[model samples]
Target: MNPRVIGTVRSHLVSRDQCPKYGDTSMPPVWIELAPDFEPAATDLQVGDAILVLTWMHKGDQAVLRCHPQGNRKLPMRGIFSTRSPDRPTPIGLHAVRILGREGLRLKVHPLEVIDGTPVIDIKPDNATLQGTAEFSSLVNPDTGQAILSAARDGWLRGLFAGFNGNVSMRQGERVVITATGSAKGHLGPRDLAVVDLATGTPLTSVRASSELAVHLEVYRNQPLARAIVHTHPPKLLALSLRGEGPLLDLPLFEGRVFADKLTRVPAHRPGTPELGQAVGVASRDFEAVFMDNHGLVCRGETMTQALGLSEELESLAGIAMRR
Candidate 1:
């Protein structure tokens, strides 16, 4: 069945300048009313599940395109296609948002660069294949299937982490392998990492990578579609999680329903234990970003890019909430 457009995107900040310049803005909360027959997949969502986010470019002034070829603030002129401007010939924007969570029809999404109140055109599942060069590893005893390890070794794992500007690592059996370099490493440490056989709970490898790994592993086990995960301790998300507050309801500056049914909150877990992993797994059942009480935030997707996008979205929402 074709996916349906269940929500309208509206902008909290109506001014053109306030709109997102890049396709990475933290979208204000917008409401999404699900179709009567629609249902989210079971097994919860992982860090990297592909989602086709349909958004209405409410602030897009299609008429303005005739004046400038490109919406380059710095350049004198370029065509709309030449630059990533929202004022396109067609004012429709489709973003792939990682599922944060769902509450009835409300879905909490991440990394939607559209302006607030933009009407959502539709949402579909993105089943794109992973690239050949993506780095991957096997996980022993994946909760779902026996070939989970083979899937990883064969690179069947989706490219969930693509285009992420962060440090990430992987674990196979007893080894911890760093996947990226530089700033990614600065945010993670060896002491914060750990690995274990999914079925047996036997220790395989452990390192101080990031306390957030607990959440990542949980989503991997619980969410069938999740192939990659990202955890970021950005100040905005951290502050919001630290507040130990309730779910984001009203969009004071922007619509809140855009993220309807997609956000979730997970109380902090005991560091470095199967319990923590189980908590993350449970929380990830349907949401992307699971606000870790007093710790940080965790986001899952079918790919790394989606996961990172959700992380950035959570941070943006946190920032918006803080300002309020």
Candidate 2:
């Protein structure tokens, strides 16, 4: 049975050739105007909600059964079904997205790699990965993504991160933008940061973002006041966290109150899991900076500069603790 066209993409592209390959993370979010017939199906959906989008790759050459992956001529040809190539017997485009905004039947979603005039086969709520959706990576706008990279490099130079460890993020509307996983933090560039829907974790881009993304998302959801976050595995902080009430807390001074007042320690929870995210969220509700037992620390602020400064100041305190 053929799928009914429930929606159409409204875009500025004048031709299919103008579209990028599927899952192009760099593409910006666009609008999907659903038909009046499918409007009732959108019940319970709201802004920031994650959805599974099914689109008919109308521009694809369905007759071609085999092709190189991503249209790369250097790769060996494979069956169309074996790769994500949009050209296939039934070019159904599958995408995980979050609702950015909605007005009547028109809705906006990010990085949906299809071109204008494409037929949308269906749209379903992304329930399975919804809880983990924020972990999915999306693209940060070029200018902003690049600016965050400079801070990331500074984080490395200042020893907030070592090797490929640590993560950084800034929230923008319905999504959270973060550093990519496994990329060298010491020498990061603009393309290093990715975006994911804040509520659903739907990756807005094709890049693989850091797994610790949940930590960032949880903080954003719990504290709308927080716009930026910095996470680091400082050796001194980790060492002190292992011992309850370390010198960082016992120091009798005004600096101690500024640094340790309302500080929270998340009970040991495995990193990169929803449980750990919940733990951080709970701790963050009352504290600007938190120490994860036997793990690391998370610092948040209204801006990246504040978060970065807090991270740096805490390091100094942790160093003092280590010396005592």
Candidate 3:
């Protein structure tokens, strides 16, 4: 069978380093330029979607490999594959990054950790294991029994909602309730928010219950580690969705850090319905944020702080893209 090569990636050289210390060293942000033929596949990638990034080890110094893999100045070395050392026989590195969004031939990805101008050899979808880990479990909020609420309420959430013009809410156990009083952009005061229990699919009594209450309920129900959920209508994100843009191009922005592991993008669905909730649940199975095409954005964090931060970052990114 022929090995399929789907996309070609190109990044410029920035610097050279050894072992785990490679990502730690300073280097310019390498812009990843994908081949034009890959645009269709590239645009189709969504938040939380994982891709295998292959890069030519241009800066690889063979002599460096003979030294300690850790380059600790004391410890002896092992084979390259044994220690994830960049100095390998093939002089190639494979990194897994989350797709943040795209601009023309450039893709913004998260967790790149590679130096700027690194030559990218190829790009492929990452289809690996589907299992939870203690890493995610550690983010859960023990006091509130919510995973991401604390992080969401912290500066992260505030940043996400900064200048946000939409309704916001919080979920208590099985009940979804309104927590914020805000008007939609260009709309009048006191917009109503509604929430519905996922188990019963019944509306709860709250003046500002979230319209997409089911979506939140689904996250809480599906992901044991999830605690807080956020929904908003950032103009650029909504505009891209309306334009039939499937997912924002991946960029290595700060928001990517908070949401690196669990970002997902859901196709647009009618707002305030069980279908919307189910769609969100599916998209968020392995992601933190899900882009709802033609509608808005939905994100679940182990803490509200994390969720909030991601929300704000998403909006800011959208704004940045719009300005560009």
Query: Which of the numbered candidates is closest to the native, going by highest TM-score?
Result: 2
| Alpha carbon lDDT of each predicted model | 0.50, 0.78, 0.56
Each candidate structure's TM-score, on Cα atoms with residue i matched to residue i, is 0.40, 0.58, 0.42
CA lDDT of 77 in candidate 3?
65
- lDDT tens digits, residues 116-208, model 3? 656676777664412332211111112332222333234333443344334444454444444324433222222233334546756533344
Using TM-score as the yardstick, the better of models 1 and 2 is 2
Looking at candidate 3, the ten consecutive residues that score lowest on lDDT are 133-142
Runs of candidate 2 with Cα error greater than 4 angstroms are 1-139, 243-248
lDDT of 1 by residue, 31-96 (tens): 344555545532233333346776656566676554343344565676566666677667667675
Which candidate leads in lDDT? 2
The reply for model 1, stretches above 4 Å from the true place, is 1-213, 249-255
| Model 2's TM-score against the true structure | 0.58
TM-score of 1: 0.40
lDDT at residue 5 of model 3 (Cα atoms): 45
Superposition error at 175 for model 2 (Å): 0.7
